[model samples]
Target: MVGTYDLHYYQIDQIKRVRIVRRSDGCYVQFCIQADRNVDIQPAGKTIELDVGLSAFYTDSNGLKVDNPRHLRKSEKALKRLQKRVSRKKKGSNNRKRAVKKLGRKHLKVSRQRKDHAVKQALCVVKSNDFVAFEKLQIRNMVKNRRLAKSISDAGWSQFTQWLEYFGKVYGRIVVSVPPQYTSQNCSECGEVVKKSLSMRTHICKCGCVLDRDHNAAINILDKALKQAGYQLSTVGHTETHNAWEPLRW
Candidate 1:
């Protein structure tokens, strides 16, 4: 309480809890604010589905690609160098402590970057589209693949999805998570289930439809989400929104 404080406008009654902590770099405080959750925000009149992947952060239904900023991979060399230096230093030495702090700071920077990226991207997506659909990915199980564990973790899908849900709540947008079952295998054009391997980057169907694999998947995801949400869509080319949501039994 001795130093000047930068604070947001908050009512005394609205403040639920506050906690302060000291860090290697600085001291910070966290506040849990109480407020009404009933918020009404108008839809943006547009809908989009997102396909998240290691190759890119996301590919939207419109074929827009958001590049994945591999914060850890980008700074891996520097982090490794600092970690190696730290390991070589004598244990319990001041130099070793400093080196360790440096490494920790580097990691903190990456964490901040990933969170920042997720927040901004999620906000933009929520604000731009009224209805947003994404695959219901099981990150815990997905990370079990040792071959893709690093890339998947680095992509920060969980963080991104959390931000998406948060923003969706704030903006009153419809954010739905559709099952990831065959969204990629089924053709977005003719509804044909063309089997393909993970290595195939392009989706080709016998119905003369050839599209980017992610883009095709995004379309399918959107369709499924709309159906699950009670909207009957014609196709990817011509999408129509319905007011009623009736569960269709296949």
Candidate 2:
């Protein structure tokens, strides 16, 4: 929605409203089971739910907000161990070949784990919500941050969008994108945009509102989408708490 992009409207459905917000998972939502199943392939619209193996309790003065990601400790440990083992093995030797294979498998496992986690979360978002919000990623400019390119790629925004598209169609959800021009620097509460470097993670508006930069951007995206869908600004936050993406409780 932020950058140069187009929505391929496959079903020719009319969008009543477009609200692009961040992926929010309720308390006790997880996706490890969906990831662990030894199925060769998964069918689309076949909604499967599970606990992602973590407990989350995030709140602020406003109320409970987004759940922090969990289940990454094990994967991080596995990756470090594999990297160390690969380092000690003789290069181009049989032992090195075996080490390389082990490393590859670890990477595969990590990849699969992340994919499973993302899909379940995305699907939950599709099911309980209407207007899905996201930054129109300027992927090219994003990739230009050479140091962060790999991690950003790993975050899989595009893949999440792709999955959102599939689930949106399946559940009759409307997807919308807004100009991602200033979702971060601009305050979602107040219409103010400031040019800040990427390192500034906190958005402090002179209007006496301070918010985490990423979250500020996320809600702004939702605002933009709703406007495009012809909804008045007053109705935007009316259902914030009641309309949360609640998946299977752990």
Candidate 3:
């Protein structure tokens, strides 16, 4: 795979494997169904063992692209069923323990599925290109955004970055984290900061450039990082910082 080292476009695929051999009706066990390199076994005791696996993904034109329609649907249904069961369980009863176990198993399944999705997307991007760029959003703060909380978490951009970094080390691919600064606001054409509401999907700049908000942001972040040596982005308008990091943290 030395040629992968010199390739300008690569389609890297990242996948996460989870060990979830549990059941709901007590008749079936469901291990992670996503693509996996394989399974690793490490002994702990006479009978106990551990399974370890890493998540993977790639990038794309719009951004990181990972999709698994069937797997996602299955995970969603299991989660909904588990949620209802947990919600009905009594506070400190044995039923609660059962419910919690079921819920935990469900979460493990979903987490693996999600991580797989992210890795697949990130890998695609990385393998498709020599240089991969993604927005460095403050994941903690973004999760608090009431409107986008679910979708943002579902997207798992932060996890995607972690996977990208892992492959970057192993593959020697250049994975870059660009600033989550005024990527959308700042005009890519003339650098004018066009203020837009959260609802604004199109970045309409006075410089006559109209681009998808996220794409605009992505391109700007990429260019800015390319321009700056130290490569720090001004998160002046994107974050919710309370300290003295003006023009750097919102």
* Winning candidate number (TM-score): 1
Clashes of 2: 11
TM-score of model 2 vs. true structure: 0.61
TM-score per candidate: 0.88, 0.61, 0.60
lDDT tens digits by residue: candidate 3, 87-196: 89888999988888888777767777788776885555445444445666787887797866656666666787788767655444455676666766788667899998
Model 2 lDDT per residue over 1-250, tens place = 3323233432334333444433222122221111121222222222111111012211221222445343345577887888899899888899987887787777766666667766886777667655455556676687798976655555555666677677766666555556667666777677887666777767788888777656566556666655665554455353442233222111
Question: Would you list the C-alpha lDDT of every candidate in the order shown?
Answer: 0.82, 0.54, 0.54
lDDT of 3 at 235: 42
In angstroms, the error of model 2 at 24 is 33
TM-score for candidate 3, please give it: 0.60
Q: What residue runs in model 2 are displaced by over 4 Å at the alpha carbon?
A: 1-84, 87-92, 235-250
